[model samples]
Target: MRSLITHLAALTPEQLSDLIAARPEALLPPEPATMAELAERLNAAPLIDVALLGLSRPELQIAEALAALGDGCDRAELAAALGVASDDADLDAALVRLGEVAVAWPDGDRLRTVPLGHVWPCPLGLGAPLSALLTEQRADDLRRIARRLGVPAGTQKAVTVRNLSAWLADGANVRKVSTTAPADTQELLHQLAWEGPYLDEPTYRYGRRTGPAQWAVEHGLIHVAAHWGAPLQMPCEVALALRGPDYRLPFDPAPPSAPTRPVDGESVERESASAAATALAGMVNLLEECGRTPVAPLKTGGVGVRELRRLAKTIGDSADHIRLWLELAMATGLLAPTEAGLLPTEEYDTWCDQQPAEQLTELLAGWLSSEGAPLHQPAGTGQPVPALVHTADGAAMPLLRAAVLRVTAGLPPGAAAADAQAVTTLARWRNPMLLDHLDDANGLVEGVWREAQLVGAVAHGAVTDLGRALATDQPEQLATVLDRLLPPAEETVLLQADLTAVVVGTPSRTLTVLLDAAADRETRGGASTWRFTPSSIRRALDAGSSETELLTALRDRAAGARVPQPLEYLISDTARRHGAILVRPVACCLRSDDPVLLKEILHARSLSTLGLALLAPTVVASTAPIAETLTALRNAGYAPVGEHPDGTVAVERPTRQRAVPLPRASDVVTAPLPLPGPYDPGALDELLAELFEDADESHPLSGYLIPTQPGPLATSEPADLARRLLRAAARRTSRR
Candidate 1:
């Protein structure tokens, strides 16, 4: 100890302060030694400086010295001092030991001692026994005492006692004066005292003046000290202890237990869905109510701003909830949005009023019934049907059914008396038998039944009679029913012209004649300027006449009858360009081997020639006769080409190469052909044979044998011949 003191004396002021503070109790001798004797004993040799202290002591030795010093001071204070430079593990151990000492100390109060040369004060005033401070058995007695003093029961007795002691020490009489515990204890006491006052009430009364504090006091969780002037605050130590290790009061009550059985996962989910549906219904109801006028709901006289506000508040859910109900109502056609507001349309309202109650009930039953309820199951499923399951209202089903009926019903006639009777009869039957009646009356009710089917109101074969009756009574409605039940017409007369065209393709020409007569009669009578009405033209076309034929007939009829100019022009224009050009192959291949003859054939005296020209070499050897003609040809600028042997002459090539210039009669007379052979049948036949045999087989005219005719023929005759040839060829191909 003397060596330790000598070492401590050698430390710097900060080091000395730390050493003294760490273990103030250790600074004094346990058996009271004189200060001078202590100093003399500690002063052995020259002391080492604080900086050199670590050089002489090992780590363990230093730690031991520090720990020895700690024993004399308050454990917490010593631990804190040692922890200043200590590692985490050592610091943790020191802190734990300090905590034990703190808890075990009398009154659980913190100890304070002076540094190195000073005296320590006793922390436990009056040196109260530790057992008295922590007396557990006294809790009940303390609670009773608290109740008698008007403090809360289950109050922290230790804290109460501390407060009472403080008041007493302040010179106030504990029994006569009033006092409060610490802030925390006061709150706890208030809560305990006030809690019981309204325990049985349905609703809690909470306010600044009548809140938790007042409630706790009535329930007894706190106590008040008696000293009046000296309000004894609860000691931090005792109040902290009352809080417990878990930080909850031992007397804090648990929440009340639920009354219903726990819901299964499915049931919980269904309940949530039901809640959402009900909320949606409420929103719809509010919207409908807003739409009603004073005359509409006579009982209310008239709704006001207050009513609207109340309605809004009643359905005060998310905007989506309101929107959903509105959409459902619109889709079902129960309500329509108008300029005024959302209102039931006449069809919807009438349907609501007239719908069969039982049918409506069945429909709504499907919507509101919960899956959990046994009654919701079908009858054969072993569960008894509930006599009465809750619904939106008894009337809701009927209204909804009516709405469905109205939406599905086709356009009504002046009145559908038969349909009304049929519906009434169907509605009279109970559910199990209704389907039978409907099946029996299928012919009468097919249309209505089909309409219902479209909206999923009834199953197939369930309401056939109703559907048929609807169809018979309301044909227009049949369109809607048909649209639902059958495919649309595969072919429709999209345009009047298209229909007319079809009519024109008919085998008989009766329609065409009638249309032509109508036009002639109209023109003769001067009924109108136009030769034919669109209807007449259509009729003609539909009568098996093509558009071109119809227009041509109109024009011919008009001209012969001296029709108006506008009418003629209309008919002519319609007919002239109405059809495509017709072309065909011909049998007569009138090939020209002589250049002079080819030119003459191409360019004829009349404008009706149809034969093509070809070049051939002449057998004549003299150049003079041919050159004179050539000069005349070159002056005329006739185009020419090299020719083959066959008594054919090749014309001189012209400056501008073009299709061979067909000869005019003037050219034929001015440039006479130098005939190489006599004008004989055999020669002509031989020429024709050679030309036909030498022609390319692929040419359309190659198969034909040319006639040895001497001159030009009629244009129509040749064209007719071509058409005949084409027909014959087609027939032959078909046979092959």
Candidate 2:
């Protein structure tokens, strides 16, 4: 296929046209149509042909077909013969030929076309030849035409051969030319050229408005018009005229070059000096206005060179004028140079203050009115006071006046004006005189007055005494005066009350006894220890005895008893020390209901170690059961006996008895007790003898005993019964 296309592309335009006209029907080798067998054909102008055919077709085919037909062959004639519209085409071959005709037309300002009369074989079969050729031209031109006709630009550009034939056959002008003038018409047009075959009104305007003449006004175009008119109406025009069409109106030019060298030294110095003097004059004037003094020298009745230089710098003036001003001020006795800076004396200050306000205004007005004066008010406004003034000699008038005031005012008390002037003229001032001197002048007398007032000097004046006495009385006045005179220290003192007791001496190690009557026997070592109950002390006193006596008795009672070492020491210490001390109250009483037990406890000289345990039952039984102790004892193989609901107990019994016999010095005895013999007269006699013996011994039970025994033999013969009982008891007791 590529080879076939390449071969076809290599063909002459005529051959290609013939091949296209043939229109092969199959991809394989095919037969060609006979030339005599003509197919229905379409014919039109080249413009319409090209619009329909597109640019990629063979141009020669189009031209050859048109040539084959006789002259004056047009789309209209061809469409008529084919029974279609004048602009329509019957065959694609005819459309391609028309495009070739349009391409051959000449290029010019107007849309060029060949007269249809130039073609052969009228396609419409008309006897007369077609008048003209119709063309669509470029797509853009077609669009413009459509837009002018109010048709939307989106309308397709392709025109049927019939349409072109009809449009051209009407004989209307088929071209457009813009008559608008160029923007630079006033300036010579150096160049000319055709711009477009298709144009719009906005595009024409854009071209005409080029150049600086249309530059925007906001870009710094100055208005030179005196009155608002055309020049003002179009300021941009003026700008453009000055800057030219291509010139950038808004561009700023480069800055002016500076001088290569400064002015001659002498001229520069003169200028500087002049400026300095002018500034100094201004300062002097300002000071006077502000009621300040100016500095001056004492020697020459003027400001010294150094002082003048200093003042000039301060007031932005030259040393020369400053010196002159200072000299005049000193001569006039208005300014004085002291240890402080140059200052106006009191007289000068007073004069300055008292000077009429109008005088200042007049001076200011006069200065401002002078020729070439810079201090004048603008035109059309009320006359204003001059901010500065200069004499014919360039001496600042205000400064001279201020300096004179300073010298005069600063004169010492009783000192002549001439003397003050001399002092100021001779003095060299290193500081500003105006403010310093004015302050000093007022401060001198004012300071003294302030001090006087502060010290109550006013109160002590002659009228005060008389007034005070008249207002009140002599006594009141004296008291008031004294109160005022006396210092606060002499008037009052703080009396502080000492409420807390503070011990100042070291404490002694004195023994103190704590008679805890609530302490039970378990807590006490033994009765031998001086363990007194709360009731014991009360009982002692109740029995007509003092605490000291009771304590002594206890001490003596425990003196020889065996007890714990700590317990003995505690008892002795408490008895010796606590007895004499004044205790608020001491009482003792039994906390149990067992009076018998209490009596038994009292009768004993000292309790045994196990005696406390035995007493526990009675104590518990008499009071409460002591549940905690009972539970503990029961768990330890001891049973509670006679326990009551109120936690009281009569006794506690060991749960089990020991199987072993008690140890004795003589022999080992393991046998249990034999049953007692039948009751008899001898048994009673024997028990009585044994009881008597046991009672006579110093033992635990010796104090409590009864001398009685049970027996029936007493009713029989007393001699026989006694004899029998004695024998029987002897026999029973002797058994081993």
Candidate 3:
């Protein structure tokens, strides 16, 4: 068969570029001078592993079927092996996907995959041939089996084994032998054929063997090799014949259809914007709370359970919901980690300054690229997988999330939306290989949908116009799309007699800021409700808001609506009660029986730094500390003497101190450590063999192997192969 380099060399420059662009994870160097160099880079083990992980279920299955066939096969032979028609559309598509990633390349009239022996030793779970397996059997035992099956008992052991293998390769002969075996023995053979080709050895004594296992083995149906231990191995040819025409492997390549419910386009758009606004408002509230009283992190790093629960109560959301939001904030750099706790970062200020559309986009983009699932954990491991915390198994989360969103975005325009089941099916079809690594694949997909909904990327199970724009990476169009879908922002609110304010629609930036500071938000949604409580009004006053300024700002926001009497009374009462006490900072007190003496000290310009102020005719206070004030008075040439708080004269004294270094510990000699021995070639070979023996090659990663020339695919004419290659390439380009 032709090498992958030769196959790639046949493509046009543009076609080659498209192929390379399709699989960036291969990490092939830029601009290869020759096809050989490019092919060599593509074949690197790590790069090949990455490419294999990207194949869809059908694509991977087809690749494995090709590998099992050993020598390459033509399209017709491949279709036959997979139990599908040669002209099937999905078959063609799967082949195209494999070809795009250079996993499978076109040979003369066939296709060949990279050498997969080092990876997948047993493709499709088929076992070794009888010829190799019988090496552990006694020659007498083989001759006895040959005689019972009516085969020639050749003197040579190898000759007898080869004849038995050829006889078993034919379906009719195998069926004839199966009819003579006991009913239980026949069932065991059929089970091993489809499920896998290995079975544990029965525990019967060597000379007193019984049961279906021994019957099958005695009939030459299964063989045990000494090197492979006690497990009996079924030859590949026997398993294929027993599988029959139905084909044991799953072969469907069509994308699953999602169940959708129709909704009004206008309603979806409106609800989507409302959800987006609510999300943003919640973020603002969380940040303000954090700024006021930042919670401490756990010793192991991450928010403690109690702290997260407290935040959930403060934010009026579930702990899980709060966790997701915190993760989003952390992911977008809005919330940063510090020694104290998670606090709003400088990026948050910039985010707040952006338009609503841009703000939502920033959050959605962060979610798309974040490393781990915030809600779901690995299968069988009940530990909670926190957001923003990296887990090795979660590396595929971003890719899986993006794939699900892409599928949603690909839906037809209008108010239609896909349910979880349909979305899950298509996502699995698109990334079967990746999903195989995840324990809770369904939960992970559902989590992505929930996260998208949180950020207003989808509404009522459908991708809104805004969501579509975000998923497609059309940031420039987000503002225009969101603007068209949402109603205009209102700059006014309705003031109620119950001391509550209600915003009828999206609030203007200025109105939002004013309400957030002066009133506490009671309910948030399409119309947010704010209540003016005593504490809230006092908080505004403490922030330097005069009663008159606060009233004027409220009336302006209220527009033509009359201000409620209770709200007016509450604001005035709170303002009147504020600052009633006269509190001042004073470090030293100057008391004198003569009023004129204290007056002279307050009027002294040389004592200006002391910040002296006369409280009464006989008492004066200074802002400076006691020592500094006394020194200033003495330097000003005043006959002032320091007095203690108890009315006694104070005296000063000085003492000297020093720190001495401790002596260093003595070092003692110790025996030298033994050196490592030299490497042994035989040991390395044995280790490699053992690793390959135990390796789980049944995984998707083990689906390619080098092909021999003159394989089944070479049966077709070269012209047919060229035509097929062109059609596949055209389809791939159109997809791009």
Candidate 4:
């Protein structure tokens, strides 16, 4: 961080101005204005939280592991404990995540979780205490030993014991662990490790009944620790010696990569986007139908088997295609779920109104704005791979998608490759295992077409105008490239003698409502066909359209083609029967023009509840009124007036209301995986200091840990030191 600050400080003012002006997100609070400001932000807790939430699960797990240990641990030991080979992708990924977040860093080939409790407040597991791993017995024995040595209690006692332990630890082996040795020896090591690395006694047995305590004392392997609240001490150097020569516990090698896939063009021609286009077209048509006659939602909130098959037949598509498109519509905000059923949301209408290019952008962008591919699954898999459901393969898909786009962007003009090539290329770069499951090969390939080629992001397997725009992150370029695919909105249709009208393409909202009102859509596609009928005409009148108004709208929208005679006749005929009788709601009134009918009604027992009143010989009225009165009168075997004011019977139409679409979700981008950068000397020094202090406080017995001592462990004569050096030189010259 300091080095970064220094580098930024040295940059020219003009360069800094350009940087701040170009990227607004960089200037946010905790934003660095200079090297000093950057350093301050690096230390801020809020910034750390921001980094933490972005971590992958393994990275977070590894971090918490370090937090629990509260110190540096060897790489090999971690690999052994995790049961992951050293070169395993997961371990690599975890290490990468830790480095990116700056939560852990390398210390002499070991990893040290830095800033301790601040970095991970809730650690995965707490490390065992030091005394449990070292001591053989209780503190009472250490007190007796102190008395025998005339070590008085207090600061003086602490110093005297510290000196003794330091002397005794000088040339001892503290971490000598043997797993394949005798059962008793292994048992002894297990007992000590399970107990935590601590010592509270002076005397000990090296094993269950070895009785090597005093012998070990004479050999300088164990001594009293008057400081650090423990009774025994094992020096740092000896602990390192106890670990195998290389120190780290080792891991097995990673499995070899599978043989390269053959470049078979057999599936090449099958990659045309007709299926995708049909799927999209069907998606729109199905949503519109669902809005018209919604089916019951499944108990699990998905389309039930009955509804699925019904929808599939309605759109003339397979069940899988229908399901895929239905889900895609919902995911892309083009449709939403309502109590009635799945329906085209308000966003659908707005989306329809958009130019084709813009709509394609929304479609493709929506494709990118998710975590998992619901439609992309391996063969024989029952569970759907929806967003937020993390799996090894599913998790890597986003990065894979991003990487391929980048690869395409880097390609030269007019240079292109098929899905097979792209998939093969990406697999080699990240994790080849991703392509091992062959269940979703078609889906994997289709994505390239529907998500990329169709959006103008890639053309002929090469990144083109819009692709360049997205790759370069230029909004205006994207718009410019997509303009070619956007369909212009129209408000007219062509009428035929068979009472059918064809809208060549999508029409404006007003025309769509009119068509929906007065005609039944027979076929939907690039060009949709609608048929006019008497019932459909009545539907128009029910939606507040008068007979005359309906005729005018039809003629105006008919592309100047005369309204079909059948359509006109159908409209007039429906209008003629539109209204014929009138009934006004009233509390109570009665008059009769026919004395016989009046007498019949007056003699009826059912009329007793109404308390029927007679105001004239020609009319009769009752307290029960309007709709309810009509039903009661009919049930009583009497016919009554319940027509509109125009003396015409009313035809009912379903009140269609568009549901509010869910808020437009932000487009998701797989943020680039962060790589470890060069660490500044100042930060390294601070971290090292903390690690050393932790080691000094407790003699770490972990095979993974290396403890620290403050001063020289022991003193020796010059002649002795010379002789030790000569023997070491002799050992070095000999064969292992």
Candidate achieving the largest TM-score: 3
**How big is the positional error of residue 480 in model 4, measured in Å on the Cα after superposition?**
2.0
Model 3 clashes, total count: 6
Per-residue lDDT tens digits of candidate 2, residues 1-736? 2223223334344543443322211001111121111111111232122122222222323333333232334544333323445443333444544333232221221112233333323211221211121121344544544444333444454443233333323312111111122345212111111111111112125323334223211111111122222221211122122222233212111212211222243343233223322322342343342223334334533334465455656655444334334333332334444553455444343333322222222222222112111222234546432212222322222222223223322333223222222323311121122223232322222222221122122121111221222222243553444233321211111111221111111101110011212111111100111233333333233233444554454343231422234433433443332222110100111223454644554344432211222234334222222444333333433222233334443332212111121221112111111112112222222222222333445532233222233222113332333243344434554793
- Candidate 4 per-residue lDDT over residues 254-294, each given as its tens digit: 32232332322223212322223343466666777777776
RMSD of 1: 46.0
Q: Tell me the TM-score of each prediction against the true structure.
A: 0.14, 0.13, 0.64, 0.49
Give the distance in Å from residue 490's predicted Cα in candidate 4 to where it truly belongs. Answer: 2.0
Q: Which stretches of candidate 1 lie over 4 Å from their true place?
A: 1-230, 238-248, 251-256, 294-736
Worst 10 residues of 4 by lDDT: 674-683
What are the Cα lDDT values of the candidates? Answer: 0.30, 0.28, 0.66, 0.50
As a TM-score, model 3 comes out at 0.64
How many Å off is the CA of 567 in candidate 4?
A: 4.1
Clashes of 4: 36
Lowest-lDDT window of 10 residues in candidate 3? Answer: 665-674
Cα deviation in Å at residue 71, candidate 3?
5.2
Error of 2 at 485 (Å): 59
Residue 370 miss distance in model 4 (angstroms): 2.6
Span of ten consecutive residues with least summed lDDT in model 1: 45-54
Tens digits of lDDT, candidate 1, 452-559? 443233322222223332323343453444333322211211112211211211111233234433342221110112135433442343234554554454444332
